[model samples]
Target: GYILFGPADSLTLFSGLLVLMLAPEFFQPLRLLAQHYHDRAAALGAAAELLDRLEDLPDKAVQKHENVRNADPGAGIVLDQVSAGFKPGQPVFSELFLTLESGSVTALTGPSGGGKSTLLHLLAGFLKPDQGEVRIFGLAPGEVRFGWLGQQPFLVHGTWADNLRLTTPDASDVAIETALRQLGLGGLIDERPEGINSPVSESGAGLSGGQGRRLSLARILVANYDLILMDEPTAGLDPDSEVYVIEALHKLAVQGKTLVFSTHQPALLTLADHILSVSGRGQVLDTSRGGGHYE
Candidate 1:
């Protein structure tokens, strides 16, 4: 308006046009600076969130040399005056005294939030007791290698033999084949062109949940761990997979291997030599042994 309406000399008109042309260029550095600030803020926020999550995680337990001991065949699992939980000063089960005999199949039946898994963790040496002792085969928990069948069966992007050989690298091919057959995976293996060497996930298709779990059990069968622990072995399994798991566990029990498992299935409970009912409040009642309760 000043250039068009007001009196303006050539020098002033040229200066006004030059400023208008250079205005965006003049603010270009400031705009870039603002964008960088925004990016820095987002990055810092993400880093802070990651740091908080890391802080919330529990510290990794360091294994002590003294805690390592050889397995004693005669001695079984013993939880004496044990109290443990995730939080400090709050125990899931307190002053608990329990004993499991060697070569026995013990079943832990309990509610969802009950300490069944906690007890298993204690036995597996995944968690430490706030007080007292947890002994497995007269040795500290985790001192000896054992079979663990968790709810989520682990698998890899490899062949059937590769998955089975994960835990038992020295397992013979014959042993691998036998284990798969024992777990009712024989049909699946035979169908594959390369048998056990065939990729577990073929043509972008992986095994079903049941098949994956059975494959995990096949590993246990080949490894021949004297003590095996399973959590909800039959949970979410199809009827066929359930039968295979039950039969496989029975076979293991017959081999004089001590098996401890947590389950709600009646079929699994029948396999237990001793059934212990675990309560949500941490009480364990031995339903099979004269209804004795452990405190």
Candidate 2:
């Protein structure tokens, strides 16, 4: 307006247009600065919320005992007056007393959400009881190196040998082959061009769920752990895979390895020397002996 209205020689029309064009460019930095400040504020708010959440979390103290009880190989597992649950004052098991014999196959059978997995977790030492004591072979739970087979099999982006060696680092090639054969993975390994050295997945093809689980069991076989705990070992497995798993577990039991597994399958139940039915009401009934209760 100044260039158009003022004296003609004072400001040229071209200079006026140039200033108009550069005006937005001159303020672009300031606009961006404001936007950046807004973004920074948002980020800080989010970080503050995260920090608050972290602060609200309960602190977990590491449990240590100077005189740790030595593991007694013959003690098996004992749960005395135990109570546990995810929430305080709501226990899954209240004053539950149980004992499992060594060198025996025990099966836990019950409805879903009946605390089968919770009991396994207690044995695995993945969870702590709200009250009472849990001992595995006279030692505290999780103190001993026991075999654990969860529903999901753990595999890596490597050869079969690599996956098996994850738990048993010093395992020999012969032992690896033997373990694979034990779990009925021998043919799969043999099919690979490089045998055990071949990558687990070839041509973007990975093992099926059952085969993957078998591979995981093979690791337990190679490790030769005295106490093995499995959570629904045959759940979601194909028919053939289930057979392989059942056979492997049977072999383990015959070898006098203490095996505890959670299963509802009739075939698996037949393998158990003792069958305990866990109920949602926190009642554990020893169904093997014509309905006896364990308290």
The TM-scores of all predictions, comma-separated, are 0.76, 0.75
- What's the lDDT for residue 83 in model 2? 93
On lDDT, the candidate that comes out on top is 1
**Runs off by more than 4 Å, candidate 2:** 1-69, 201-205
Off by over 4 Å in 1: 1-69, 201-205, 289-291
Candidate 2's residue-wise lDDT over 1-295, tens digit each?
3545557686788998999999999999999999999999999999999998777354421222321335675888999999998778888889899999888898999999998999999998999998899998888876776899989888887888888898789999999998888778888877888998978753224788898888889999999888999999999999999999999999999998999999979999989999999996778888996547875
Please give the lDDT score for candidate 2: 0.86
Clash totals for all candidate models:
0, 0
Q: How close is candidate 2 to the true structure, as a TM-score?
A: 0.75
Q: Provide the overall lDDT of each model, using Cα atoms, as 2-decimal numbers.
A: 0.88, 0.86
Q: Distance from true position, residue 2, model 1, in Å?
A: 23
Q: List model 1 lDDT by residue over 155-185, tens digit each.
A: 7778889888988899889999999999999
